[model samples]
Target: MVKAETVDKAYEIAKERYAEVGVDTEAAMKRLETVPLSLHCWQGDDIHGFLNPEQELTGGIAVTGDYPGVARTPDELTSDLHEALSLIPGKHRVALHMIYAVAKDGKKKDFNDIKPEDFDYWIDWAKKEGIGLDNNGTFFSHPNVKDNMTVASPDKNIRDYWIQHGKLTREVSNYIGEQLGQTCYNNFWVPDGFKDNPIDKLTPRERMLASLDEIEAKDYPEANEQDSFEGKLFGAPGIESFTVGSHEFYQYYAITRQKLWTIDAGHFHPTEDVSDKFASYFPFTKKDLFMHVSRPVRWDSDHTVIVDDALLRITRSLVRDNLLDRTHIGLDFFDATINRVAAWVVGARATQKSLLQAMLAPIDQLKQSEYNADFTTRLIETEELKSMPFGAVWDKFCQDHNVPVGFDWMDNIHQYEKDVQFKRN
Candidate 1:
């Protein structure tokens, strides 16, 4: 382990270098501490929530590997989450799907039948951890997702069942925010589309909009519940031809309804990116925007995030546009192949590292150069900024927060696997 004084010495040297370029390392670290990345709970258990363990995971989602020690109950998931959070710097929130709701008597309950009390334990757990909560209505992997249709189902009964579930989920989200004293970002996404070319794509989309309207009709207090919509380009094998909730559809819907629009990293095509949409949607967002930061390999594989160019660009855009506070960032990838806690720490740290790097950049200088019409200097400085001592600043940030710096976290993960996870089998 690197000593505190050594980390401080590295920070002081890096701090002087950054100061010369008009960036304050200390202020950047302080800013990063306030940004809470919502950690998705599905990663700990590979999205196999404690809802109905007997049901098979379907509806375009699958956990690739059969890695052992997957959390089987709410308590086990909570324990794993606690271990992961300890390794990640700064306070963070947890993102929960409706399926994670725990019944008081440990009985299985259907979506529509679920209540806020089902999530009482989560709220209590969040309180103890001193973190906030975000929520999502699970719209896939259920019987009601008949023929891969959820909110956009042509059948009235199937549509109504999902709508009731959505309404109930919103209520639970509101309750969570009310209990935690922070606005919970309640997101809605559906896997409604056809495998082959559809004769009428318009009808399904229209149905989905109506179903969502009905779900949102049950107005909850804005202070507690802030709702948003997510759109995907495609889904599992059969649903590639048409995903009912495409990006354009939800972008228009969110604009019209004046709600936050969620941009999931894995929801877009590999060539396309949401980094450019920051300025476009920043004006339309009412209160705050939301993002599901997942690493997409070719498609929505939900790979653990690394400090790649795409992620750096996203964070840079947010920092350059001054939208960090206006955006609610959350991690949303699940890789069952590796140690789940290590996956969380890796992705969460990568996210924090990217944010810190962006913050430490001399964006003001770059902007000033651009405004002066010195395009050559702007290009040169931007390229040169890449090699700056951002790692030193990141090390200091982790040191200040008392979390492991760099690969030092791997030691803790190895110990955890032997002491906790290996015994799960």
Candidate 2:
């Protein structure tokens, strides 16, 4: 256990070091509080939403490992989420898929038939927890998906079914936002693609656009609900050839339609630096951006995030360019190999740590050095900042937030597993 006094002393020393570089530790911590990460609900249950837990996870989504104690009900999922949130510093929103809706009064609803009332339980829970909610339309793992398509399917019936689901999802999202007094981001992503190189790729994309247009026809106030479109590079086995909604597709769609564009870190090529794309979009994007932070190994593996170089670059890009206000950060990884609650705590804290490190950087000095063409100073100072007492600042931040400092949180997770998760079976 790390003593609070030791944490305070280390923070004081770290504060003075950062002061030498003209950085305000207090202000950095304060700024971090304003940016909240939207934690994905699917991670708690491995994407097996309550609507149909027996359904196979389709649309190129796959969660490996037989880690016991996965949440099997809405209550279990939320309870696990509460446990995860307790360990993570700062208030954050929970992102829900339409499939997670809780039925009421012995009533059940499918994706297309579910109403906002179906999500009342989640809304009430969020209200009590003082957190916000985000939502997504479930486009896969349902009977309507034909030939690996939903909205872009050649079958109008299949397309219309999903279109209705999309519309209802937006309604539910808007309701949740209004109920919670926070803006709900409703994101749309489909697994419409072909296994073999389709001779007619343009037609599927055209159909997808029309379907999305129909879904967006009924608009809600941006204050209550904002819509986003997520694209992909490739998908599961059958979707390897052609993804109808590629990054290019959504980029144009989002800009032209004035909707938010989602950029999942794993949805791009392994070599691509998603951080670099922010500057490219910030100039012309009239609306805010949404990001799904995940670590992809070789392909879209959705590995648990650590405080690695890619994450650092991403958080640094946002901080250095002052784009935190324009971007909504969210987690998108699901790893069933470890303790589920521990995975959430680790990923969330890693993200928080990266953001803190970025906040602690001497960004002003680095920018001035760049503006003056002092490459030597710019390079050296960036490297020097890496060696500074960043862990102390992070520990202080954790202390201030009343979350565990350092690895002490792991002990709590083990106890929870023994008392709560392990008893699930």
Candidate 3:
């Protein structure tokens, strides 16, 4: 089942997966002291009940598709997000990311649903209210794709309103920034890549690069603007057929001064090292970073909140490498037709639990320093480098550093154990 109950379900799944059927794992669990599946779980039922106070997450406004039933109009959407943020008193911001469904026709969206006036209105409205937004999946607010209904036949060789959307986005964003009198973060990434026979659809890196160059050339300092890059694991094939870590994205930064990659950890599978595939674990962060942090949703595109163990290791790895600046944790979700606020809460809690797992590291600077150099060398040209097995190498690494608590899940010894058991069972 989709990991609907992130904390509860993940633990249950772990319990089942860890069990050996006839073989014994009770002994193993006893030996390990913990299953180590400590996820960050938060109760998401607080959105409607802000009547009582005192609860909040850290600084980050996750721009998301509207929460169901809760926010419909632009006013409600903006207000709902604000309510979530208010609950977390110490937290100046609560994270958010958008899915197009909020403001568009569900499966068949059109341009009439969105327009420049729509853009002008929201920009002015956000400025007046001092609100900000971010997009993670296909967004109606997106420059080109948002108006998908208008371009009945988008140019295959060229993106539909891609550049136009960029221009509009720039106008709206800058207007908001100037109005809010604060820099608002803009994130870019559509589920734009194909796999296998669909390879020809791979984004022409040069063309995309040129588009980015055009935007950069326009003279709006987008890099200094709060923007990030995010990818989804599942979506309509036209936009979703691509694999997770396409390097074409690298050129995007080559042209612009903006530096941040939105990392949806669950977007990758067990075999891909997201760091290598994208560029480096720290390339985007070298400028600014926005992380779409969550566990890998296996074989499907449901934004379930469970944090994959391997994804956690990636965070620790990033910490080891000093790449936290790019780490604006955006927890995205769209599961069942549940309460809008609860859906947001589910996604938010899952992200938190994943972070808890990420923090498992005991923080050995010496080992991390040594590992960082070696990891980079090996990761030179691989995608999803955070999810590979180099157990022998890691063992030697720990031995060399003389730190006993360091465990790199990149060394897939445990995964191998899990795989072997799956076959046996």
Candidate 4:
């Protein structure tokens, strides 16, 4: 581990370098503290939620590893989350799926009949942790998923059941937000599609639109509850041909309905840059944006995020456009091939690092160069900025936040695995 004195000395020198380019490192770090990432809870248990431990993961979703020590209960998942959160800098929120709800009475409840009280255990835990919560309605991996569709299903019984599930999720999300005193973003993403090219594609989308309209008809306090919709390019084999909620579909829906729209990094085509989409939407929408940051390798593999070019571009776009305040950032990847807790720490920290790098950039200077048509200076300065002492500033940020600097946090993960995770037989 690097000594505190060395970290401080390096930060001082790095701070001077950044100042030369008209950037305030201190202000950047301070701004970073205000941005809270909503870490997804599905990573803790591979999306095998507590409601149905034996239920096969259907609806075109699949987790590819058999890593041991997966959290089998709500308690274990939260404990693991606590450990992961300690190593990450700044305050963050936990995003939970409705399927993870706990019953204090030890009785199973029907999906449509679920109440806000069912999530009291999680709300109570969040109170103690002093962090806010976010929510998503579990539309997949349930018995009601007929013909691989939920709200868009032709069966009225199945469609109504899922629509009611969506409505109740809004209530539960509102309760969570009220308790935690933060706006809970209730995101909707359904696995409703067909494997082959359907001749009646128009019918499913029409049904989906009507179902969503009914779900959003009930009013909730805007201060506590906000609804968002997520779209996908494709999914696992059976549902790869046609996704009911395509990007165009949700983009239009969110715009017309005045709801937040979510853009998952891994939900688009492999070559499509999600970074560019933000600016395109800002020109028209007045609502806050929601994002699911994930690393997709070749496909939507949901790999553990690393500080790569794609990740950097996404963060840079947000920072350059000055849209951090209006954006809700969240992680949405589950990699069961390695230690789950470690996966959380790695992905979250990678995102934070990317954001810090973006903030440290002299965007004003870069913009001025562009306006003056000084392409030469813009190119040279950007290239040189890459070699600046970014690592030092990052290490300093970690130290200031009381988190482990550099690779030292790995020691905690290893020890936790031996003492806490490995012993989970």
Candidate 2 residue lDDT tens string, 1-425 = 99999999999999999999999999999998898999999999999887778889887888999788899888899999999999999999999999998878645557777879888999989988899999998998888889999999999999899889888989999998898888999999899999998899889999999999999999798989999999999987788989999998998899999999999998998889989989998787789899888999988899988899999999999999999999999999999998888888888899989999999988888999999999999999999998999999999989999999998998998898888888988
Clashing pairs in 1: 195-238
Model 1 lDDT on a 0 to 1 scale: 0.89
Q: How good is model 3 by TM-score?
A: 0.53
TM-score of each: 0.98, 0.98, 0.53, 0.98
**Per-residue alpha-carbon lDDT of model 4 for 1-425, expressed as tens digits?**
87999999999999999998888999999999999999999999999776767788888778988788899889999999999999999999999999888876776666666778888999999999889899999998888999889999999999999989999999899998888788899999999999988989899999999999999998888789999999999988578899999999999999999999999999999889899999988778899899899999888889988899989999999999999999999999999999999999999999999999999888988999999999999999989989989999999999999999999999999999899888997
Off by over 4 Å in 2: none
Weakest ten-residue segment in model 3 by summed lDDT:
34-43
The residue pairs in collision within model 4 are none
Best of the two (3, 4) by lDDT: 4
**lDDT preference between candidates 1 and 2, better one:** 2
lDDT of 4 at 338: 97
User: Candidate 1 residues 172-288, lDDT tens each?
Assistant: 999999999998899988888889999997889889999989998877888899998889999876699999999989888888888888999889989986799778886775656
lDDT of 3 at 3: 23
**Candidate numbers sorted by lDDT from highest down:** 4, 2, 1, 3
